[model samples]
Structures are given as C-alpha cells and as structure tokens.
Target chain A: MLEQFGNFLVHGLVTGSMYAAVALGLTLTYGILGILNFAHGEMLMVGAYIAFVLTSRLGVNFLVAAVISMLAVGLLGWVIERTTFRFARHEHLNGLVISLGLVAILQNIALAIWGADPLSIPPPLPRTLEVWGIRIGEQRLLAFGLTVGLIILFSLFLKRTRLGKGIRATAQNAHVAATLGIRTERVVAVTFSLAAALAGLVGALIATIYTITPFMGGLPAMKGFVVMILGGLGSVGGSILAGFLVGVVESFGGGMISSIFKDGFGFVALILILIFRPWGLFGQRPEREDV
Target chain B: MARRSWQALPLVGLLAAGVLYPRLLPGDYFLHLGIVVSLYIILTSSLNLIMGITGQFAIAHAAFYGVGAYGSILLVTRLGVPYWWAWAAGILLAGIAALIIGASTLHLKGAYLAICTFAFSELFRLLLDNWISLTNGANGIIIRFVPPPIGIPGLFRFDLGSRRSYYYLMFTFALVTVWFVRRLARSDLGRVLGAIRQDETLALTAGFDTRRYKLLAFTVGSMYAGLAGATYAPYLSYIAPDLFDVNETIYIMMIMMIGGIRSIWGPVWGSILLVSLPQALDITPLLRMIAYGLVLILVMIRMPDGLAGFLDRLVSRLRPGGTWFGEKA
Candidate 1:
C-alpha cells in the first residue's frame, strides 16, 4: 500500500510540473496586461507542430527542434500581440473579443495545417529506472526537470533583471509603471514573448509524453487557466502551488474516483472560486467596490 | 402615442415582411431557413441584453441554450410532460440557473464574471455529456413529434407538422422578442443598464442598484436563450452537445457584434445575412471560420458600432435634415 501511494505521488508530481509550465505564461500575461489570452494554449500547439515538422519532415535533431519551436512560437506570440492586441489593450471588452477571435483564427490555422489526427514523437530519453518499486521513466524525469529549471530561471529573471523588474512593475500598476518612464509597451511585448516561449517549450516537452494534435491545446489551456485562477491570478507562487495540488488531486481523482470526471474537478473549483473568491487564492481584493 | 405610431412604420413593415415571407416564398428550404433565422434572432437578441446592452463580457450563452433545450426536451421525452409545459420548465430552469449564477458571480467584474460563468456553463455541458443515464452520454436525445401548440380544445390546434407553419410560429415569437427588447431598450431599466455599462461606479454612486439590474439582465437573457433552445429542439428534431457549445456562443457573439450591439435590427439583420451567406456562397468550413475571426477583429478595430453603426452613419449622412425614425444615432 505504501509503494502504491508512492507511485501515485510520483505520478502526481510529474503531471503537476507540466501543468505549472503551461500555466506560468498564462498567469503572467493576465496579471500584467489585464487581458486574458484565450489563444495562449494555441501557442503550445504551434510549438509542438513546429517541432514535429522540423524533426519529422525536415530531419532536424529533437533537442534543436525544441529550441527552434520555442523561439518560433515566441515570435508568433509577439506578432499576434502587435497585430491584434496592441490597439485594444486599454479597452478590456475589445481585448477579450479580439482574443476570442484570435483563438478561432489560430485554431483554424493549426487545423488547416496539421489536420485532426493525433501525433507523437519517440521519447527523447528511452531509459527507465526503478526507485523503491516506483519505476521512473527518463521522459517523465526530463519533463519535470526542465519545468522546474525554467520556473526557477523565470523567478530569478524577475528578481534580478531590469526587464523583469519592469514587467513586475507593470503587473502591479501599468499606469504607474508608465508614469515612471518604464516603457510599458515594450515590457508587455517582451512579457508576451516570454510567456509564449514557456508555453511552446512545454508543448515540445509534453509532445513525447502525450499525443500531439492540432486540438491538444484546448484542454491544457483550460486547465492552465484553472491553475492560474486557483493560484490566484498573477500570483506566481500560487500558480506553482495550485499546479501541483491540481495534479495530485487529478492523479488521485483518476485513481480513486473516476477518470471521466477528472477534467471536471478544476472547472468545478473555478466556479466555486468565482462565487466565493473572485480575486483568487492569493490575489488581492480590489481596493474599491462599485456595487 | 400617435407620433410614436408613425415612428414605428419601419418595425411594422418588418413585421409584415416576416409574416408574408413564407407565403411569398413557398420553398421548404427557405421556410426552414426562416426558422433557423428566428432561432438566431432569439439567441443574439438575448445575448445583446447582457453583453451588448449591459456591457458584461460573458461566454456562458450556449450552456444556457443547452440547458433550455435539454431541460424542456427531457421533460417532454423522459417524464412525458406536455410540450408547452416543458417550455415553461425549461425557461424556469434557465431563469433559476441564471438567477443563482448571476447572484453568485455578479460582484465580480469583467473577465472574472466571464470566467466564472464560463466554468459554470462548462459544468452544465459536462453533466449533459456524462450523465448517460439521463442525457444519453453525447448520443443525445431525439424526438420525432413536433410540439403541438397549447390552447383550449377546438379553439386552436396549431399546425406544426409543416416547416412553413413552424416558420410562422418562429416568426411570431421572433417578432414578439424584438418588440419586447425594443420596449425594454426605451424603458427605465434599459437606460439604467446603459448607464451601468457606461460607468458602473458612477451608476452605483447614483443609487441605480447595479447588481440587481445586472442580475435581472442575466436572468432574463438566459430565459430568452432557453426559449430559443426550446423552439430549436422541435424544429431540428435532435440536439447533441454540438448544438450548444462555446463555439456556438462565440458565433452568436459574432452575430451580435457584426449586426450592432445597441440596435434591435442589428442582430436580426446580422443573423439573416450570416445565416444565409454560407448557404448562398457554399464557402468551405475553414475559410468560413477564418472569415468569422477576421470580421470580428475588423469590426472591433475599425467599426466600433458594427453594421448598425455604419448604417446609422450612412443614413444620417444622407439625410441631415430629417430624423431617421427617432433612431438613437
């Protein structure tokens, strides 16, 4: 029984890291810009597709393909923001409508290119090790390691770098940040690219674990939003904590309850949070209430 | 009232056109299209009540539409409830849902409310998808008989057997919904909603009861959606999860945005043109969606008021000396 529980723990940790990786970008974007990118997961989809194309069609090395896909998706994210979001950033409703439209546009473009079939790559690491009756696969370990590493790197970047400081300031108060000559637009654009790159990197990492399809982005994207909400929108620590918590809950829910309803838990939590705490788990309450 | 009667000439003409449409065009396909158009008219107009007029950004519309369709249809099918009574059940369930949901989430502004409602709708959709014992688990429920109209014996037995007749039935409801919304637009509540949309803080300061108005809009809007879905189940004779999905909600949003959020005719005309355009042009599904996305972006960026706004401008430009039927523009 102890061994079985250990296996569940390991499984949950693996899944949790991946969820955090995908959600990190989402929460950051929402926190800073006050705009939710509905098409954010499609960034993941685009990255995976690019990696698949490079490795499968063009015969590039898998590791190199991963890097290329991340950068490419980052560039795509930048272009999308510049074209669609830049003009409408101030108007929240317009930003939402534009983002929704972009979701449709990106999903369609991916569908047109990749079709609807599921795709996958051979695992980058083909070895498995047993740790106390809990077998560990190289692919899972690699995904977990990279996610943790990137998250740490991101936190450090926010802590030390000038641009990162600028992003944090903008998230706290875009108007004040601009008033201080922070170049808020550039910070926003950079933030979008960084978030997009993280999502893209995660897409490539997870492609080896799950089936890579044009529509693979939707569920993860929804879950990413869920994690962000759970963690409290814009709370980096909250996102990570909620990501792992969700993964464990999902792992147990799938193992103990029913797998079919596993997807529903996060959404259920989202509704409850909205009703009970619209601000989120770690978010600050609005200083002023209109009604 | 007499001056208002003269001002209502265009609306009367529209009502007459809707009434005469089936008679003039006797084609089954056209009549079928009419029912479809009416269904969208209901969807867009109700959505307008919340999103367009109230300025609440929400994405739970199709879920409400689904609840209405499933609620009424299940009553009629599973429990053998009377068809008309099932509609009441559906509308009631939808209104209750909106009331409970709106009350819970109304305090959250903008995307927070949107995400909350969206998640709630997803919950409803999942229940419909998984509760196989009840909802048939995505296989969906199919009903063969058209819902007969409810009335006293021998006084009226409505003919729902024919699509043309169904078109008239839809037309009557559609006309009524439009007129109802029009009346609401010019009423005290409508003005308050507009005020809330413009500036919720100021509206609150003015003691407008913003939450109550928002809740009212959300509940009434949901009821309209349920009514549309109840009408739709009979016309199509089948409904799967596909009929009421986020995509459907976005499509409705597109229709409302394209037509004119603030105008009654905007959604009506938008639905008419969009609903018939693909049928007329035979555009492929991918290209059609691309066009949808493109139009949404273009409209938001360039034409803030949508087609109605553009038309208002054109009419005003042409006849600077004359009032355009007491239109808001």
Candidate 2:
C-alpha cells in the first residue's frame, strides 16, 4: 500500500510538472495577451512532433532536438501572434474563435503528416531509480526536475530581466506600456514566443514519458486550463501550486476511485472550484469589464 | 410593402426548394445530406440564441445535444418507452441541464464561462463514456427500434423508416426552429437578450433580470439542441459519446459564426454551406478539416458577423434603408 502510494505520488509529480509547464505558458499568454489561446495545446503537439522528427528521423540528440523544437515552436508562436491574433486582438471572442480555428488547422495538419497513430521516442534515459521499494523512471524525474528548474529560471527572468519588466508593464496596461515607450507589440510577441517555448519544452519532455499523438495535447491542455484557473489566471506561483494539486488529486482519483473516469477529475474539480470561487483560488475578483 | 413582398419572394422560393428537396434529388445520399444539414441548422440556430443573442459563451452545446440523444435512446432502448415520449423527455432533460449549468455558471462572464461550460461538456462526455453499465462504455448504443409513424394510424401513417421521411422531419423541425428563433429575435425577449449581449451591466442597471434572461435563453437554446439530438438518434440509429465531444461543439460554433450570428438566417445559410462544402469539393476529410480551420480563422478575423452579416451589408448597400432577412440592425 505504501509502495503504491509512493508510486502514485511520483506519477502525480511527473504529470503535475507537465501540467505546470503547460499552465505556465497559458497563464503567461493570458496575462499578456488578455485572450486564452485555445490553440496553446497544439503548440505542445507541434513541438513534440518537431522533436520527434529531429530525434527519430534525423538521429539528433534528444536535448538538442528539444531545444530546436522549442525555438521552432516559439517562432511559430510569434508568427501566429503577428498573423492571426494581431487582427483579432481587440475582440476577446474573435480571438477565442481564431484560436479554435488554429486548433483545427494545427491538429489536422499534424494528422495529415503524422497520421492518427500514437508515436513515442525511445527514452533517452532508461534507468529507473528504486528507493524503499518505490521505483521511479529517470525520464519522469528528469521531466519533474526540468520543470522546477524552468519555473525558477522563469521567475528570475521575470524579476530580473528588462524585457520581463516590459512584459509585466504591457500585461498591466498595454496602453500605458506603449505610452511609456515600452514597444508593447514587441513585448506581446516576446511573451507569446516565451510561453510557446515553455509549452514546447513540456511537449518534448512529455513525449519521452507518454506516447506522442496529435490528440495528446487536448487532455493536457484541458488540464492546463483547469490549472490556470485554479492557480488564479495570471499568478505564476498559483499555477505551480495548483498544477501539483490537480495532478495529485487526479492521480489519486484515478488510482483509488476509478480509472475509467480518470480524465474527468480535473473538470469536476474545475466546476466545483468555479461554483464556490469563480475568481479562482488565487485569482483576484475580476472587475466588471467587457469580454 | 413593395419591398416586403420582394424580400418574401426569396423566402418563398427557399421554402419551395426545401419542400421539394428530396423529390428534386431522389437519392438516399442527398436525403441523408439534407437531414444532416437540417440538423446542423437547428443546432447552430439554437447556439446563436445563447452565444449570438444572449452573449453567453457556453460551448457545452454538444453535451446538451448528447443528453437529448442519449436520454431518448436510453428510454427507448432500456425502458421501452415510446419514441416520441422519449424524445420529449430528452429535450426536457437537456433544458434541465442547461438550467442547472446556466444557473451555476452564468454569473461568470466571458472566458470564465466558456471554460466552465467547456469543462461541463468534457465531464458529460466522460460520464457517457465511463458509465459502462448505463451508456454501454463507448461501444455506443445502436438504436434498433425505428420511431413509430406520426398521424392517424391506418388512414395516413407517415412512416419514419426511410431517409426521405427523416429528411422531411428534420427539415420541418429546422424550419420550426428558425421560425421560433426569428420570432424570439423579433420579440421583447430577443431585444432583452440583444441588450444583455451588448452590455450586461447596462442591462442590469436598467432593472432587467439579466441572469434570468440569460438562463431562459440558455435553457431554450439547449432544448432545441436536444430536439435536434433526439431526432438525430433515430436518424443515425446509433449514438456514441465521442460524437458529442468538444470538436462537435466547435463545429456547431463554426457553423454559427461562418453563417452569421447576428441574425437567424445566418445559421441557415452557414449550415447549407459548411455541410455541403466538403462534399461539393470532394476533398479528403483531412484537407477539408484544414480548410474549415482556415475559414474559421479568416472569418473571425475579417467577417466577425459571418456570411449573413456580409449579405446584410451587401443588401443594405445595394438598396439603402432596406435590411436583409431578420432584424433591422
């Protein structure tokens, strides 16, 4: 029983890290852009596919391939912001709809190229660490470690970097940011690219643990949204806390309660949270604003 | 009066085409396509009431649709209830669901509401897929029993066993839905909904029970979606959890957006165009879906009002002071 509990904890942490990584991007983009990118998950899919091609097809190193994937996906994100989202930036609904459109386009394009079958890269680190009868995959540990490191690095960047200050300024008030000579557009582009890069890293990491598929992003994306809400829509720290909470809850729910409804736990939690605290656990009460 | 008659001419002609559709084509495939289109029209039109009119961004429409489909199918299959009764029950179930979901989440404006609704939709789908004993666990329930004929037995029984019958049934329902929506859009209720959509705070400040109106719109819209689903179950003769997922909801939303959300007639046009576009082009499903995505993005970016809005502009431009189709604005 203890062993099982430990295993579930490890599993939850691994999954939770991915959720955090994805939610970080989601929260960042939402904070800066003021629109939920419904297609954000597709970035993960695209990233994973890119890395898959680099490693599996091109025989590149996994870490190098992941970096390349992140850069490529970040560039894609910049292009998306410039082309599609830039046009509908004024209307939240239009942005949402456009993102949905991107989702379809990206998913279908992936489907056409990769087909419907799930693919997984051979684990770069195949060793399993067993401690007190609880075994944890090195890949899982690596993913969890990387996520924590990324979160720390991200916070430092936000706190210490000039560009990060510019991003925060833009997120606070685009009009003010622009008036202050911040180049709000550049900040938006940079934030989108950075968020996309985070998602891409998560995708590349996740590909090593789970089978990669075009549709793999959907569940994680949904979970990411749930986490984003739970973490207070724009709070970096809130997302980190909520991500683990959700992952643990989901793990236990699936392990103890029922596996068939495994994917449902996050949604149920989301609805319950929305009912009691619509503003989210960590989010401030939203002022009356046009959406 | 002269302009009114001229406008009615196209409507009359369209009605004539609808009535003569099965006969004009006389093929099972065409009939099938027509039924699908009609079903979509109902779905998209109903969605317009909430998203377009009431200004709620609930995307769990497919969940309500599935509830209706599954509710009716379960009743007919499990308890051996009459088809029509089951269908009615399905629609009622959908309404109740909408009421509950709307009551709880309607207070949340914008993206929060959208996410909440989306979560509900996924939850519903999960329930349908996981509750194996009840929903058969994604193997899906095949509807073996056909709906009994309507009208007087022996004198004139309109058997619903054929594609033509299903086509006409859906077509009639679609017409009724459009008419109902049109009426609602023109009525005080519609004006209130439009007001809410434009500015909820302003509407609330003006002594309108915005929540109640939003709930009403949501419930009514969901019921129609349920009606479409109930009808769809018998037509498809198979109901599955996957059929009513987020992708399906997105498709419905896309149809409404592409057709035009501002007017009732937008969905009617959108349904016809989107439903037939792929078939007409004879493209692969993948390529077709990609095209759909492109169209959705382009439409949202360029034509926020959709095809109906574009047509409205064109009509207003061609002849000043005369708006096309539904409302003046």
Predicted model with the maximum DockQ: 2
- Estimate the TM-score for candidate 2: 0.94
- Candidate 1 versus the native: TM-score? 0.92
DockQ, candidate 1, comes to 0.53
List runs of model 2 lying over 4 Å from the truth: A287-291, B1-14, B152-157, B325-329
Error of 1 at B59 (Å): 2.4
Q: Across residues B60-138, which tens digit of lDDT does each residue of candidate 1 receive?
A: 8998888889999999989999999998899899898889888887887766676677777777777888999998978
Q: How would you encode candidate 2's per-residue C-alpha lDDT over B1-329 as one tens digit per residue?
A: 99667745645665787998878888999998999999999999899888988889898999999999999999988999999999999999999999999999998866678888998999888888888899997899988888988867676455798878777778888988887887788788889999998888889888898889999999999999999999889879888999999879988987887888767788888999889988886788888888878888898888877788777788888888655653422
Worst 10 residues of 1 chain B by lDDT: B320-329
Best-fitting candidate, measured by lDDT? 2
Pairs of residues clashing in candidate 1: none
Give the docking tier of candidate 2: medium
Error of 2 at B243 (Å): 0.9
